[model samples]
Target: MVNSSALSGNDTESRETLYQSKFVYIAGIAEMIVVILLILCFCIFVCFNALILNVYFTTPHVHEHARYVLFVHMLITDILYLIASISLFLVAIYAVYIPMPICYPMLNLAALTFRITACNLAIMALERYVAICYPLQYFQFCNAHRANTSIILMWVVGAVPNVADFFAMQSTVEQDFFSRNVICDLSLLAVNPLQNTIRTLTFISTFTLVALTIVFTYIKVMQVAKKAGSGTSSASKAGRTVMMHALQLLLCMTAFISTVSETYLRDSPVMLLITNFLVFTCLPRFLSPVIYGVRDEVFHKYIRTFCLFNL
Candidate 1:
């Protein structure tokens, strides 16, 4: 009654304070729900990977084939990739400052496994191409012994850019670089002009070669399928397999490019989490079990028992 303006000001301030608090409370709950969902999905993938791997190991007929061996190798590489990626995510979310020495290995492992995963898809396509197009030479060209050797070569091929980036960072920074503690991030490794340039150039060159290899394999396989003159021939199926691999490679490339997209998304934690985790990183790995593991008649037959028992 005495001063209506002052009373209105107090009421407005109280409402604004309450609104701010409610907004924060809602944001916290939403972030927690997202994290829980992420963890649940991750665990499910791990279990599925384990079940498939167990079946592969326990069944001699399945594990003895060159194609199955290659499949197993891909799964193992993916598991490594998933573990490394999730570890990085957890640390980032918790704001844990890990020492450089410890963090470097984890970061590089993530990078290395990512490269290996892409290479694995390319090699697997080539394996199918050889099996279908040149059946007579399949045993010689893509046998289990050769499959194991290819896995080793994949790691070596993947390590080149990582080693180069490390040396480049070393050249630019002081010797005490390893003594400090910082958040484990890919951007941290690319902190210098030289490192960023190398990263960009390497990304362009390496992925170009990978894409070309996948495209070449897919085309060759398709040509062989057409010449076979039968819709149900192994060549046709192999052609489809190569196409599937191309899709998986596309997913992997999407994850790599997320680092580039982070600039626009840095301010929004929710956006970054969704884009990086759901769309790019985990989507490909999650689809692997569905696309290949469940769809393969042989694999499906073997895992049916395990699924029924576990269900």
Candidate 2:
């Protein structure tokens, strides 16, 4: 009876070991696939943004307009965000946690880029509203100089919360070499009560205001479009473009929620967290060039000419 029991215990242990190995193998494959996808996204973002920047700069008509000015700034922010995402991906691939000295700044910059992108989208929506609803006032309201000033102000406002986050991380979080790399994870760092409160309030208030403004502006624009019978087709096209921007904003907001939640949900599956992160980081960036640049008639003409000449 004792010999039989010993043999059964040995068999159970062997099965457990085999199961662990198999799980690890599957996880390794998943990570590899994710890494490859991230690399592809990085390439696409860089190439498409570069093309857009080139066309906008080379074409006087496109660059001189206030709307394109805002679009250019949006592209810049997307590039910055992509850089941060690439950095995070590298850390993940290496499986080594970077020290606080490097991690804090990286996370802060990512936050800044995020804030700027949100501001840019809101500005774009406002520009579209004015153009569609109040065509005469559009010129007075959204001049090139004014657009430049707005972008400068956006950078200033975006930096404030991130600067606070940097200080908060410095004060509350100690350098821990043993900790796993949580690259670009602002919530992972230790933050004091005051800093946490400020961060939360700032994030919620800014996003809420921006979102409400976008929604209201777009609704008004659509109403105006509906009333303009002869111009309905052009107005409808512009509405679709605005809708694309709205979808991008929605994706970004969802990404923010997923990122924050993933930090605290320790029991959540790893694959799900990775999928959410990838979708949030890559999808919006990918869509920006497509929705804003490729869809533009001028950009399409330039791209086709360039391609034909090259061929």
- lDDT (Cα, tens digit) per residue for candidate 2, span 1-311: 99999999999999999999999899879977877787787787788778788988888877778989998898888788777766864675355567656776666677788878888888988888888887889889988899999999999988888777667656766666325455434545646776777777887987888888788877887787787765646566667767877877886676576566666654665566566667776776777677767678888787778778986
- Candidate 2: segments with Cα more than 4 A from true spot: 1-12, 89-95, 166-184, 231-234, 304-311
lDDT of 1 by residue, 1-311 (tens): 74898899999999999999999888888877777777788898888888788888887788767888888888888888888887887787667999999899998898888888888887888888788778899888988789889989988878988898888888877788899999888777776788778777877777788889889988998898889899998888888888888887887787766656656676776635654666677777878766888878877876797778877
lDDT of each: 0.82, 0.76
- Model 2: how far is 163 from its true place, Å? 3.0
In Å, residue 111's CA in model 2 sits off its true spot by 0.9
| Cα-based lDDT at residue 92, candidate 1 | 72
Q: Could you give me the TM-score of model 1 versus the true structure?
A: 0.93
Alpha carbon deviation, residue 99, candidate 2 (Å): 3.5
TM-score of each: 0.93, 0.83
Judge candidate 2 against the unseen true structure and give its global Cα lDDT, from 0 to 1.
0.76
Best by lDDT: 1
